[model samples]
Structure formats: structure tokens, C-alpha cells
Target: MTAAEVDAYLAGLPQDQRDALEDLRKRLKSRLPDHIECLSYAMPGFRQPGPKGKMVVGYAAFARHLGLYPHSGSVIPLIDCAPFKTSKSGVLFTPAHPLPDALLDAILRLRQDEIAAGYGRRG
Candidate 1:
């Protein structure tokens, strides 16, 4: 999604939830800079272009939690170390819960590696 689209979506969320997601978005942008691309995928997502020109990272907002989708298999280790709860392919963190910086950093690093290796593409 475009930045405006992301802003509008965030605006519609409950205040605290909106704030938390927005904060996370800002952190991702600052940390990854040109490495991350914002777009809509069922919900707003941050993507990393893969070595094979596919999407490597896909993050979105769910009803009760934020969903972090790391398309690379290497993300498994980081997901395992995540302080917040996760299921299947994503990390699920609530607005009331604090952001897991270490986990986030690890995720960013994985995305960087995927991009360097050429694993996905931005939609």
C-alpha cells in the first residue's frame, strides 16, 4: 500500500492499537530505510525484495495482534527467540504488549540477508 493508505488504515484502528502499529512501522522504516517497502496485503505489510525477486517480508495487522511475516526460512530462529507469542508463520503481539526490539532487529537482519541474497519482490 501507499503511505497514505497505510495512514488511513491506521487511523481507523482503535487508538492504542493504532499507536502501537504506527510505532512499529516507524521503527521498521528508520531501521531498514530503502530495504523495506510498505504495501497492502490483506492488510498493511512491509516487504523485502527477495533474491529470486519475491516478497520476503510480509507484515500486517490482525484483530488482536500485529502479524510479522518473514518469508525467508531463516526467520524461524528469530521467531523462536521472539519474546511475544507467535503461531505458525508469524509473530503475534498485542497493543498492550511491549514491542520486542531484539526480535524486531533480528527480523530486520533476516530481511537484509534475504534482500542481499535476492529472495523476493515488492508487490
Candidate 2:
């Protein structure tokens, strides 16, 4: 999604989902200036390195769940994702069942490490 799409997407969500994602967005932005609001893989995302930046993490709302994509399939294993459903690329949650704070921290830290190791470095 583009910036406008992101706004529209969020705006179109139900109140609870919107509130949950907005809070997630804040937490995503809390770490670095590079984690700016944008789109990644056509979803609501944060571009690290700021404008025209590499995608660090992104999220999207689905009919049944929400997603947190760290842009690295490998980073998924660094955290314990026992209770939630996880794919090779991301973790899935619901508004009634968002990821815990510790899991979010672990995901962010692991993503940073992966980036520093040149996982998602843009040309």
C-alpha cells in the first residue's frame, strides 16, 4: 500500500482493528527514525533508512487476523511464537489477540540484527 492507501486502509477498518493497528504503528516507529510510515509489499509498512528506505517491518489486516512482517523469513525463529500462528515470513494475530510486548521487542531486535547483517539492504 502507498501512504494514501495506508491511511485509507486504516480508515476503513473497524474501530477496534484500527485502534490495534495504530498502536502497533506507534510501537514500530518507537525504535528508529528509519522506521518511517510507508508501504512494504503493498501493506502498511515502515521503511527503514527513512524515505525510499528498505522495508524493515510491515503489517496488514486480514479478515481473520493481522500480520507482522519483519521482511526476513529467518527472523521468525529468534522469538518464541508458540501461542500465535506464524508463517515462514511473519506472525499472525487478531485484534482480540495481538502479539505480546516481549514478542514485539524480540521481533524488532532480531530484524535490526538481520538488517545490520545485510539481509534487506537496498541497492
- Best candidate, lDDT: 2
Each model's C-alpha lDDT? 0.68, 0.82
> What residue runs in model 1 are displaced by over 4 Å at the alpha carbon?
48-56, 120-123
For candidate 2, lDDT tens digit of each residue in 1-123? 456778887999888889889888877777655456777676888777645556778888888889999888899977789899999989999998888889988888888887778875569
lDDT of 1 at 108: 67
Candidate 1 global CA lDDT score: 0.68
TM-scores of the candidates in the order shown: 0.75, 0.86
Top TM-score: which candidate number? 2
- In model 2, the Cα lDDT at residue 54 comes to 67
Clashes of each: 14, 2
